[model samples]
Target: MGLALKPTDTLIVIDLQNDFCPGGALAVNDGDTIVPLVNRLQQQFRHVVLTQDWHPAGHISFASAHPDKQPFELIQLGYGPQVLWPDHCVQASTGAAFHPGLETTRAELMVRKGYNPQVDSYSAFLDNDHATPTGLAGALRERGLGRLFFCGLAYDYCVFYSAVDAVAQGFEAYVIEDACRAIDLHGSKAAAKQTMVELGVHLISSDDLL
Candidate 1:
């Protein structure tokens, strides 16, 4: 998302798309359940930003794209161990489109990632290696938003990584846990919560904001 809009303590919506919701190619567990809460939260935050996973068809993250690799299988990328996904989030595909349930009107900026055929991006702030940084932090900083609120889609992956990177980059970060679902890959949902606890990231329910 470009930072052209008036920003107010930027609210980052991470990965709210069809492929991550139920009945899509790579659905998260109970992913659609968070849409209502996210919609509600959008009403409270004015400077809303959204991240979309706009992968090319047969991008490197897909198991099908890599012969001998299978979905949920791990492979060593130049970055490190990466999990292959069921072909998903293809750009312009129905599964890659923003989830219809997402309240898009509130979003002033919608950042699309994972489009690079060679790189898979989980965090809005960085690609998987943490080597490349997306301009989210800089944009938020430019807008004088030192504090950021996060909600949407997979709690364990995008949401978790985004929150961690936000805190690591000196932005106060808040995660609305109730507004996110999890992939729970090998019980990652629990691990993510633990990591947040250890990182001193703030965790709150959507009710806490009300």
Candidate 2:
């Protein structure tokens, strides 16, 4: 039998934007395939939140901003090791928009991250610096949400980090495995799964939530 969603459980859809989907600047493999699954999952929860990777042009995370740097290259930023990416999800650009096929009318909140030109954000609750918060934690707590179920694009990066942070912030965190796709850069997907397991973030499939 599937686990039932409780009233205190919230679904967080992470970075289901054009740039993360297939045919975009930093496309993830089969990233668009999760949209329909996520749309259906939204109906199972009472509270739904969506996250957007809204980076500014010339953002520090963009490889194009640095001479001789390329996407996926590692760089030492003030926060920590950062993976430079193709200029994607620039604010107000088409790539920054949510996937056209995503059904978001039921979303109660939308958190926009990575807008800071100086620091890149991966977790919806906290920026890479680990000091600045996106205010998601407070919002969830305000709504009395005690558990978070995540589903969306780029599982190895944003989705993974968000689930980690969700547990760190004192909420039960879960990742809907089949409802997400990974970039898997240099085996990041496997590494991320290991890290998430170590952090006590539960991994489940969409069917498990039914």
For residues 71-159, what per-residue lDDT tens digits would candidate 2 score against the true structure? Answer: 88999998999999999999999999999999999998999999999999999999999999999999988879998999998899999
Task: Please provide, for model 1 over 23-80, each residue's C-alpha lDDT reduced to its tens digit, 9 standing for 90 to 100.
Answer: 9999987888888888887777778999999898888899999998789998999989
At residue 192, what lDDT does model 2 achieve? 99
lDDT score, candidate 2: 0.94
Q: lDDT, candidate 1, residue 9?
A: 66
**How well does candidate 2 match the true structure in TM-score terms?**
0.98
RMSD (CA, Å), candidate 2 to true, equals 0.8
Candidate 2 minimal-lDDT segment of 10 residues:
1-10
Clashing pairs in 1: 1-111
